[model samples]
Target: MQETQDPVITSVKPKSRFPKSVPYIIGNEAAERFSFYGMRSVLTLFLVNQFFNPTDNPALTDQANAHANKLHHLFVMVAYALPFVGGMIADWFTGKYKLILYVSIIYCIGHVMLATFDGGLSGFELGLLVVAIGAGGIKSCVSANVGDQFDATNQDLLSKVYGWFYFSINAGSMISTVAIPWTYEHFGPKWAFGIPGILMALATIIFFSGRKKYVKVPPQGVNRNNLVFITWYALTHGSQRKKGEAFLDVAKQNFDPERVEGVKAVYRVMMVFFFALAFWAVWDQCLSEWTLYAEKMDRVVNVGFAKFTIYPGQLSTFNTIFLLMFIPLFNYVIYPWFDKRGIKTTPLRRLGTGLVLTALSFVIIGVIHTSLDHGGSPSIWWQVLAFLVLSAAEVLVSITGLEYAYTHSPKSMKSTMTGIWFLVVSFGNLITAVVNGLIEGGGWWATALKGANYEWFFVGFILVFVVIFFIVSPRMKERNYITDPVIDGEVAANTNSL
Candidate 1:
């Protein structure tokens, strides 16, 4: 058999040097997020106003809210679920760059359909299906691609790079989310939808321009046993697995040393991923219930000098604003402070804190709703407090999750692990979907949420989930592998020794 040639290593690059493609990737992410959040921020209100048919009292049109709510969650589910296929296909068949490029074109078509058919249900549904194809397909690959650009050499930048990468995302989202609804209100849905489509095109163009500079990882197809199969192998075959055995420890008797280490790391990450479900479930309320809450509240803005009325949907942009501020503070100030104080401040630990903050945000909203139930009209700034808390949690759980997904997974399973990470979010949206269903049906919980007692749902149930995950988070292990892998020869030598 012929030997595969070694990849040529060039001279040492300076630490200050960032990847040539990084600016483009960051630009693409920002624009893509703008495309997504712009439409999403207004979707519920839009559906209730134009698309969904109402059967409730002509005055209280919440009769059709159930349909709109169901469809909204279904859209979220489809968007997150397809990543399973996209990530798996990328791992074995298409690789990240090609798959993203192909799906992005479809994404643009979805947006065009929205621009063309905002008044019709069928066209919107079709457009959503197309957008889901592109959005879900790209989710797993784009973040993983960011990690691909780094190696042992420039590993120092991963944390900050991810921070800024996330910042760019929310920056675009903040701008478009604040602007799109106004566009929809005045310029019309055609322009509102069309603007996002244009941004998606720009995102695609920027990404394509950087293709030559991207660190393209070759796809390892179905023939390889990825982390999922390895986990299965450990669970099914290893009876002598001991306590504190990093789940991959079960593989010591069956696999090589390198494979064993990889599985152990993957296992630890999966454990954290499971607990993360609560955070996402609670966090995504910004898309649904928060908008609903905003509609019921006052939105007259009087900022010191200038005053203008704003749409309730524009309130969602607060998250983007908070995220931009918090990510840097966490990256430069918070995490560093922890490390300086002899605390490891691991990803799981951060995730646990994020959940607490999310629960707190809900508590604030619940109280505000209670006040509204009393017929006292408070300023919209109350919701701003909630968004600030939630966005802080986003910086904690989300950006940390990005770093953890890349550094913790085995090289071969990185893309798949990324997909599974988002699958956790789908599960979160599923939680909201179930709640929406329960609310649609007449129930004690629904009655409480409906008639001004909504405070208990956040302060009671969601907070309980936060406490549960906090207890479990400490049990999940953290393997901080910031540096890249050793040479293949070194890995093979270690395997031989094992």
Candidate 2:
């Protein structure tokens, strides 16, 4: 018999234009991010101003801020952590498309709870929890869904698509970061929260409209390829290992070799994500501690053409705005410039360089904090400069991370690997929450972290992680796994299956 060919595979020529479904995905992402970031932009302020009573005492104000910071970070921790669950469901049960659609309705409902219960603390907390669950549930699926749209034929566009995906995220974030805070200030919490709810509904509609265009990969269902079972089997069956055999390699005795190798790839990628925890710990502070610091600074800006005061929450817009600028700059001018000079700007190099920049951003924040501690009002321009550095780091670490996680992942475990990447951010926020709890407990560590020392301590903390990343990263081998086009109803071969 003549060999059969998949029509989808043959239709796509090499180096073809972006997949047809890309615009819809990009649109959905932009609207979804606007909703998420809009609600988040005003969260800290809402907690401090509305949920808690205003206090005249400086000490009481400080306590409220610390408490708000703890709640904020904890909320973030839960949001990032639940992606693991989302990823599993996508891989084993519903697949990416169905799960994202179902969970996004829950996301819209969470926003409703926030808008309706703006006055009560308990209700607000409930709303936040629901929103976190909804947000986290769809997180891994949406990103991985973007990757599923392409196969071997146009795999070269993966990096560029991811870049545009990230760009849309920042573009939505930049607009919401400015607009939501202004809404909160003028029309109050109900309107501000409600606006994001509206945007999220639009996001859901946008995603659904593209259903026919998407390359829908069916869920794999429960299988021996499950990483958890493979690891357990490996641990229990270790005695069966032959001489000079590696640990995970022992699993090959029972499981398919490809499945076992996928598990090993997960382990290697996770090791890189481990060092990323410090970066996230420092990065998320831009929302909480940094916003509080902005409250104490002179926010007035007198431009040659206009004059206005920037709200504390609005300061976050600078990071998003800078990201909009930096993503293209790095992709076009900077990376190309380095390539021409015989310098390779690899993903690991970008991640390591980002870590160093994260530390430097904090160093700048530490100086401003020192000036504030002395009762000197610093320019908001100083905070802007710090955000500039931090935004550059975000481009290197976060955008690159999305591409790294997708590419390094095995064909069978893409969503799971992406979930693990988000888990790194969850752990980073956990560290921040722990530090805040310690400070609230009033201990020696608290004293060390007091006032300007807080920023300095984080600076030292991130620098140490940066050094550790540089030392360990070069040792990690790279694996690029691209899914071959669909054959009949099944995904075809995967390049570099091992």
Candidate 3:
């Protein structure tokens, strides 16, 4: 039997300061998020109010809610699904740096397309296609690039760095989510869409500023075939002929140790992703289902300066606003405080807590829905409470997820596994799309949920899976992966699951 050893990561000297590239990357992310969420804040409203007029077709008017929601989810589903192709290209062909640069330009063009042909269905569809391609293509690389900035010596700082990363994202998101809605209402759709395009241009420029400062991982080249060959060789060699052998045990017995280790890492990542997949279903609702619910409520605010009425969609900003506050609190005070007490707040534990909080947010939503159904106009303050809970859930699941995917992924497949992580989110949206299709088709679910209305959406059902995954998550093998120097002529990935 061959006994090839896996390369062990060597500890390097930790830099006294964070990488010079980090601020630039964080700046780029903030601006890019502003561009992305700014457009997203008003998309459904544009489609419903302008793209298709209710006066022309009564059926379109009646089903406008479902149609707009479905379209929004479909856009998200396609955007996330495209990352698999993007991840493969980044990992095996063009490296992440170049791929991100190229795709981001396309993203800017998409914003221009949306701005130019405001409210046209055909143009909207085309723009969404191009934007999805560009956004999904770059998403995998960007997240992994954050981790590439650190190595074994300072890997402990990754979680905190990701928190700040997410903080930047929400900083941009909070602003755009609030400002864009007002822009759409006052200035117009063209201006609103154009603003995001301008931000995208700035984002590209900011990213390029970090070019020399970043540690760029070169393309590893394609070796998916090696995986297939190893699997075949193991099965044929009778390596599984032992008591209590599990599936893939033959590969472990016959393949190199590095290959077996890579396989194990991949397996652990898969387990975490399943739970993450469920978490996304609830988290993403802040954009889709929750917005629809918001439109039904009253929106009056007194900032002590003046009394102002706002759009319901603008309420989405609350999630980001709270994130801006909470991320720091947890990173500096809360998490550190717990560490002093020897309470281990591992990623898995945080994930489980996030799940429980997510379910609680839905319960709050359900209560609000009941009031709305009974013709009691609940104040917007009630939503603040819900957003606090939900945003806490997000801090746990989404932010931790970014760090988790990069750290847990096999060295060779960093970008590829990150892409797969996004695909899990895609699957969540697909599930929502399917269920909505059934409800739209006027099936038994539609009849059953008629009175329940918006409250009938799957909070408890998703929570059930979250609990199941949480129970299984402690069993997930946790490991710390740092940026390692490439070994000559050795494949970065050792697993057979390319």
Candidate 4:
């Protein structure tokens, strides 16, 4: 990796230069990733056979791909939805760390139930919901907590920390996705899932152990105040305002003049959050529908030492593997080269590229599906390439977005904004559910799969979103909120504390 000076890098220190907090966060993230990917990697396969409708027939399976797709879509949809609720819970009652710890326990419970009992449709669905609730709570809090470790004083290291943080997530995911699926395939479902449950338990324990080492930023009610101020500002500045503005009459009592700039700043961040809905709608499919598609492909690998069998759901591991490899290369080498040439590598640029790359990934899958439709047996390398491309895009968008959103939002509203980001994924999964339903109906599914047009359907769907996001990108603010300090009677020196 090159050491060329980038404005982004100069503005934020190398995460390597930071204190011990980096290791703590990385450790927590690794364990969390192991728990998440271990379960998620096998969710589609488990739902179709082990949990929902236990089966043994090979050629014509008891539960078809369509049913698995629908179940996968709904599971992902709820997982994304619960984050909003979890974020709110963190804000109003429990703090972020507390919420993460508590929900993770519930998450472990869900895995235990899946591993131990006869989880039929209702039982399995309940387990998925529990997992979602736990995941949502943790997802809402954890990334921002990583940011909490650094302030403006040491914020120069933020990009590096974020890079390393993402690396840890992939490391954990790669192991679980590959190993857990293999275990399930051969050793049986109990060991596959039970192992993840143990990992989750360990993660929760690790988090509690490091409670004192973490940054304890509580959720402040900044949004509620911002809304009141906006209402007042609208009423006072209106050309059609009466002698006594009715909206301002109600709003003025709650508005504090001392926090006016802070209120405006929070609103500005909200502006960017509104645009990400479409990006996530397309991004979430990698887990939900894509997994099922990969499952259908033939993935028998014959190595010298042993014969390796690949599961469709386990293909997600490739994304994580590539993510681990690419983040450092891009952050240290690729972005720096671009930066030397005066190209902007800010969060917005990364995010825009992510949108495009996601579209491209679907395009690749669509092409494969098209060839396979003509009775072609596509090589596994195609899927591998797709994961590689998608991982590059993941680094550009997903990891950067996590770092960006956490740093940019009002300190008090961090969890809420994280929840919003997850909500965008929820919306995406919901859209996927609708799309899946459409494909299942009106002769479309048969035509696409039989004619190898499934690739076209997937490609066409993503292209539609790619165009939508392109139009939306310009409206997004390129300048970061992290650079702008919200003054609220605290000394400027304390800005980093936020």
Candidate 5:
């Protein structure tokens, strides 16, 4: 697993305006993140304020909370789903750059609608749908395109590029979380959402301005080929044939072995996608119920040190900030330490750690909420502590997982892999919606709140799924090809799992 000699590696050089290119992308990412998160941070609050209750009555607050949670999950579900369609569009017709530009415009338009459409419930719902489509489309396309900038040669620089990317994202989150929440408190939704919409427009323009310098990979025409599908269909049917099915019916019928191998790789990744649903079920609530929980908590003031108010939604920024910090920390410290000990931080191991850590993070949250239910608000330090652990787990899992999927996936299926990643989140959101509905309908939430809190129930269910995933992850890693710069052109020797 460890090699002293450097492998034959290709270096992706910086473009002519290398400095400018990085900033442009980073700036665009930062602004776009701000726009997206800003709107999201306040969406639940807005719904609760407006449509959540038709009349001002304290008794109707529960109804409002239920409605807001439903809307939040629905927005999240659609947001994750649209990426599949957006990725397909990029892989087929317009390519990433053009698709980003087009979808971004739609995203901004959705924002504008959100800011202005303060009419009836129907108008608000319509606005959310538009924003979801636009935002989801952009998310699906832009993120994949970020990887398109580097290839085999410049792959080593990916860590650094992604580091900056994470930094920009966190920075944007910091501002949006603080500012948007504040705006919603002081000003109206129009002002709060309008500012983010304006920023999104600027982000789009900035991305397009740097278009000439970016590496633009045309989509691989694999899916467009009729022979591939015909071969796949034959293979599918052949598997269902009676005992002693003939190879001539499947293997010999216009099937290419290489294409078969590619398909197997894609399927392997998709199989692993199921495990991720549990992770997202826990992870995505950072924006939904978790924020609501935070809104209800006591805010700590450190007037002796620095005078400033802390918002619960702003705490999510810790994930991004820690991501930025961990990018360099892992690359410089952890990777080298592991390399010295003759250990490879395989994606499976990373993902497993992420799941465990995420579960632990929720446990901490459960404990804090338990304290709150016991007639006392917990310290903000508890939330911060959980964030620290969660962020560490995120570095191990989500970042590594993204790189793993990108490299393991065949070039033709890069966008497909991205879409699959989001699909896991979509499924998770769907599960969350179901759980929320059940909790609301059956009124089982009160039972859990009696002890260490009901949020623990969600955490426990997710952790159970995660433990099962760990049992299977070793085999999953074995199935994937190690597509690292250190192992160029050398396929993994252990491909028996496939």
Candidate 6:
């Protein structure tokens, strides 16, 4: 095997203030998220009102609801699943910077197709496919890029930066969630979709402006020590393994020890993502299932000074609003409070607690749905309460998951690991889509979980996974990997530490 050459490195010095490139990345993410969520905020309503069933018939309405829900989740699944492919490409062919810059252009084209092509479902579905590919291709690269900016010299700031990164995402989401729905309602699909396309274009430009400043980690070209080849060799050549050795250890006889260990690290990170699958299955429903529920409830609000109506799509803004509040609260107050008392808030602990909170949020939704089924006109505030709980869970699970994925994986496979994390989200959405289809098809489970029972069934589904997460979380080992700064054209020793 040939020696792997280290790429030219540009990074901050020891104990330096925040990296200068951070603001550009954060700004780009804010605009990109605005574009993506803006389009998604109105997707189900657009599909139902224009494409799926444009009739007033009650039976068709019911069918449209089910179809819209399934399609929405299916789109999310495809968007998320493609990240694995994108991550592989980024890790093997194009570096993160190039991959993100080029695919963003494709992402903009997808939005253009949605805005300009008013022909029918064929064009619209094609646009969705393009968007999914473009979006997924850049997903893992963008997040992994955040971690690429730091090394051991300034690794303590990683968690704080991740928190602010999440804050930027929700800030974008908060604006678009409210703005895009109103645009869809008053302006029409063309303008509603077109506006987000413009935002995508802006996001691209913002990213490009930082071209000279970023720490560009060059791609690792195809190597014999790739995880896939090692895993396959281990599986196929098991006869060489010693008794009582771990499965991957069999490959160590023929491969570099460090490379083999990196494969094991990848496996460990994937195990965590396996349990996170159910969390996302329930979490992504905020835009689809929860919005649909909001449509049925009373939406009027009285604030003494004024009265206004909250649209179903706008109801999602509460999640964003709470996210903006909770991120700072948790980072500044809650986590610090825990630290002062000698309590450690580990990533797995945050994730487990988040799953329980997610379950509690669904319970609130189930109660509201039950009231609606029994002819009780409940206020929309009940749904807002649910969003409050769900948003807290998101802060814990989603943000920490990003930090965890970046920190746990080897430098060679950071994007690949992050992509796998997203693949878990894809599977979660797939579960939701499949369940919606099954329920709509009227099977035994569907009959038993009809009406408000549907929400309760999901609550139980999530709780089962929550229990599994806790049971397995304690047994998993944790590792933190940070990049080693280059010195005088020579790479320093490895800085991987527990």
Q: Pick the candidate with the highest TM-score.
A: 2
Tens digits of per-residue lDDT, candidate 5, 1-498, equal 986997889987655323336667888899998998888888776777777665756566554655677678888899998898887777777787878888888888888888888656687788788888887887876766677776675667777787688678888888898788888778878888899999999999899889887877786543632334745576677765456753323543455544444555566676666766777776767776667667666766686978666676677776667777887898789878987897766666667777788888888888887776577777677887888887887787667767767768666566567777887788788877766665455356533333345577777787787878766665654345444332443224243221
Assess every candidate by TM-score.
0.81, 0.86, 0.80, 0.76, 0.82, 0.85
Clashes of each: 0, 0, 0, 6, 3, 0
Ranking by TM-score: 2, 6, 5, 1, 3, 4
lDDT of each: 0.77, 0.85, 0.76, 0.67, 0.72, 0.84
Candidate 4 ranges with C-alpha deviation above 4 Å = 1-28, 50-63, 144-165, 209-223, 226-253, 256-278, 296-298, 302-307, 342-349, 403-415, 440-454, 469-479, 482-498
As for candidate 6, its clashing pairs are none
**Candidate 3 per-residue C-alpha lDDT over 455-485 given as tens digits, one digit per residue, 9 for 90 to 100:** 5466767677776875666555555556443
The candidate, 4 or 6, that scores higher on lDDT is 6
Tell me the tens digit of each residue's lDDT in model 2 across 240-311: 988998788888888887777778778877877877888998788998888878988999999989999898
lDDT of 3 at 149: 94
What TM-score would you give candidate 6 relative to the actual structure?
A: 0.85
Best by lDDT: 2
Off by over 4 Å in 5: 1-24, 53-63, 144-163, 208-222, 225-236, 239-252, 335-344, 442-453, 474-477, 483-498
TM-score: the better of candidates 4 and 5:
5
C-alpha positional error of residue 412 in candidate 3 after TM-score superposition, expressed in Å: 4.8
**TM-score winner, 1 or 2:** 2
Ten contiguous residues with the weakest lDDT in model 3: 489-498
Residue-wise lDDT of candidate 1 within 312-338, one digit each (tens)? 778888877777678779889999999
